[model samples]
Target: MTRKTTNSLEEVHESVAIVQNTSIWKKILAFFGPAYMVSVGYMDPGNWATDIAGGSQFGYKLIWVLLMSNIMALLLQSLSARLGIVRQRDLAQASRDTYSRPVNMVLYLLAEIAIAACDLAEVLGMAIGLQLLFDIPLLWGVSITMLDTFLLLFLLNKGIRKMEAFIIALIAIIGLSFLIEMFLAKPDVTEIARGLIPSIPDSTALYIAIGIIGATVMPHNLYLHSSLVQTRKFDRSKKGIKQAIRYNFLDSFLALNMAFFVNAAILILAAAAFYKNGMHEVAEIQDAHRLLEPLLGTHWASILFAVALIAAGQSSTITGTLAGQIVMEGYLNLRIQPWVRRIITRLIAIVPALVAIIYFGEAATGKLLLLSQVILSLQLGFAIIPLIHFVSDKTKMQGFAIGKWTKIASWLIALIIVTLNAKLVFDEIETWVTTSENPIYIWLFVVPIAIFAAFLLLYIIIKPFVEKNRTIPNLVPHINEIVVSESNEPIVYSKIAIALDFSKTDQKSIASALQLGGKTAHYTIIHVVETVGAMVHGNETHDYETTSDHYYLEEYQKALEARGYQVSSILDFGSPKKSIAKVVNENDFDILVLGAHGHNWFKDLLLGTTVDAVRHKITIPLLVVKDH
Candidate 1:
């Protein structure tokens, strides 16, 4: 039997209801929460390293990079939301629908790696924040961060609205903390305004600028936003879809700008406090915390910074967990409990982080955080390119398809992301080759991986256009394509077989068979003796259990014969499924009837299900009657 398609986050998909005939403002308010959850990715701890590095070294010159990146994020996030609202499929599911299984597996693995990379940054940031505020040891703080798995479970159990409220509260704390810090730093408004003009001072500045773009326009957020927008239950009508698109675009604009504010505040505070003091080397989160008190001459400066760091880590981690669930469910159609998935994703990130902190010392976290953002940048194209192609398909989207100019602009954004990521990888690899004492590993390891990644990217980009002319077969036939038989003649069964165990459900199976075949058809009563002796010796064994089964079969046969139905009984030995299938196929039976106990999965796992097994082995139509 063909199964129905499920939603991405089936637990929360269409969980939020939009009331019809409501005020305009009330309708807009219903779509408010999804994009805010997505925006947390933008202001995650991964952004901190790039923003701090850019602000301190260039002194507000790289602000234009942040602006441009924010604009790009707005556009791409909107497109992502549009895809989910119209197609009702997340990015991973959509990819699985179009791409081959091997290609989908590769994409799934890449997405998993990106989430782990993002989580690494959050783990480090939370650890650093704890160390700064409570004087907790960094290693101990890292261990303590795992306890939030329970906190996420609590919020999720309360429902999506409560979860959104919890996240918004955390966002407000981060925003308010940064707002006060912005006032404390008191940056020069004119220089900040002048910094909006685009400029790159050096190669180092170019590297930091790409990091800013990577940090701001995160790849995971595309997979995230596409699924998140589906949480809201809206109208499926044309007017309803258009309204959902408009309101969600507004949500992305506002929420991402709020994220922009938090990021800009971090950079501006870094510039006004560090660069203005001639401290051009402040790149680490802990280093920034240490210097804030003395440079700003207020203890609150450092205190607020640490508080905001913890909140940022906490908020981003929650959304990261949700994104992991969506990707796993969409690509593989596999799901576990939310808390179980949360622990697994966290542990994958924690191992590398604990190793860096314990073996290389706490200072290693600064470089590790920046490396995480670069990893996210590398995986960006695999997500964005497919999304643009899916949304731009005129055949699938019809009237909702993106227009010609929007398609061009979407591709332009994808090109910029791919180009910047390529440049970043090339520059980093060149530096590694030049600086390494032995460059053979780079040729053997790095070069092959890069070539493979490039080929995969090229395949996804070019496959859609190539397959536009070719017909892709549908697994199930559509209603219009199926031929209807006008004949309404009744189905008549001449020879009917009934398989039964000696339980209360046995009568129901016999009754159903009698209803179908009536008195005119011949009835064959089949039973399998599943005793230990019968299993070992088959027809030769003469155990008490087998004798009892034979006696019960005779009683059933005599009762059916007394009702004027032509009936015969047969008792077989060995496995129930294999023996029953053999009896039905060897005889001239038109249909086989059996009883289902309606057991749960746990019961089925422990004691095997005979009905399920028997159905697959038999050739004729099998009818199942459930015991209430």
Candidate 2:
């Protein structure tokens, strides 16, 4: 796992790697960091408690559940990596692009809620780890997690590879600790093998099974894996992409199986050390830690368990914070400094967790962990539905859409997950209503709300395919200085700039700029000759001159000058976004105007260079005249 590291990802989202003339093994090595980062979520402390519970209560019966969940994780994560590489948009960004503002807002909020729920589990885990290892108070331990993550993020700033190495080392600590646990707990091999045979003991077993699946297939990992894989600057060539996908799959498959092993080992240890000894009530993680020393006849076993718990919690916290940022930036179209966002997310997660720990005391943390996972389970559909929708769509992914079998398999997985989540929610509500003399409550509040929730879920699942991809936001530049003269016969102003694509909207942009500048305004017409992704090997966009955009830019320049407002045109070759920005910034123009057609957010990402990029790169008052 060792490799040379250089260059920080500070202030940069995508990172550079040594991708030139490397062996396949080296390329795989370069792509290795992201999947292990994602695997952390699968083995977080929430999963720890569930695994412990399932194993101790049922004695190795839930091992098949662990194996199936890992298979599901491997399939989903590989798809996530594929979406990022080919579409060049993470799940959040793709979702934002696909949905309208209101739907995007709802999805965004749900994603934030999911992140908070996950962080709560990690916080409780960290606090519990501290209590076990150092005997710290629960509230104080929660506070310590924030500082611990702050340090982890500082290391992250040193370089992404360095952070990757640090996380891997922690994962190694976890794996090694469990290896020791397995060695100590010499369970019957035959019985352990039997545990992998699929059979639920009862309805109670189904509940534990649901918990294991929910905890294993995390909602945040979809966003995290898609975004994190972009950090390695791989070649965008045909062969290069094939290589990237291959390496990414290897990384995901290997990492998730490792997670499966770690998870299964925990269950095996629990079954051998607790269930075999008739300590079936040792379902809580803290209880397991407490009982381990006595059962295994060594204090070091408990210490190692605590150490592994801390590693799991801290590692998950880092990934959760990163997922929060991705969701926020992608959906909100706003950026918060990473450290500030991390602090805010930590603060949010700690409050409810702190209250629960205080109200329910030390023993209730395990129950709190389970509750936190339910919160996570609720948001699973929000993430999974959009992900499958985007990756499966031929329009969104172009020809890179998933294959037929993969598409069907992904949808089936999504359905199973959604069904499990619904069952969990319904089971909880039914427990309350039937236990009470409350047919009235069910007739009124429960029935209507349940119906509404079902309808909403149906829309979320269906809307991506049904909704039109065209975008028509109010894109007119709002400037305080835009005072339209009443005399309207083209007032005189000097130096106006308009970039044109020769669309009718380009004429609108020209007219809008002319009206603002008036008769005296000299015009500098700019055209950037660029092919989207033309230089990249796998890119379908081809580079050439004498195209329609060229003709439009030229004819418009001639037509505008015929109206007698002195005009000149500049044509440059490169990326339109960057080249246009350069033209606007280098020239002394009063303003820059570009025609923007209503384009879906996903289209904008696929197109790569948009008016949005131009706006950020220039200081001039830029007017984005809407074409729609």
Model 2: weakest 10-residue lDDT segment is 1-10
- Give the per-residue Cα lDDT of candidate 2 at 15: 47
lDDT for 553 in candidate 1 is: 77
Candidate 2 per-residue lDDT, tens place, 369-396, comes to 8777767777787888778887887775
Tell me how far the alpha carbon of residue 187 in candidate 1 is from the true structure, in angstroms, after superposition: 0.5
Off by over 4 Å in 1: 1-3, 469-628
Q: Which residue pairs in candidate 2 have backbone atoms (N, alpha carbon, C) closer than 3 angstroms, thus clashing?
A: 490-519, 491-518, 491-519, 492-520, 493-521
Quote model 2's TM-score. Answer: 0.78
lDDT of 1 at 198: 88
Q: Candidate 2, after superposition: displacement of residue 252 in Å?
A: 0.3
Best by lDDT: 1
For residues 291-389, could you state the per-residue lDDT of candidate 1 as single tens digits?
Answer: 999999999999999999999888887788778777887787654555666787678777777988889898788888888887887898999999999
Would you estimate the TM-scores of all the predictions? 0.77, 0.78
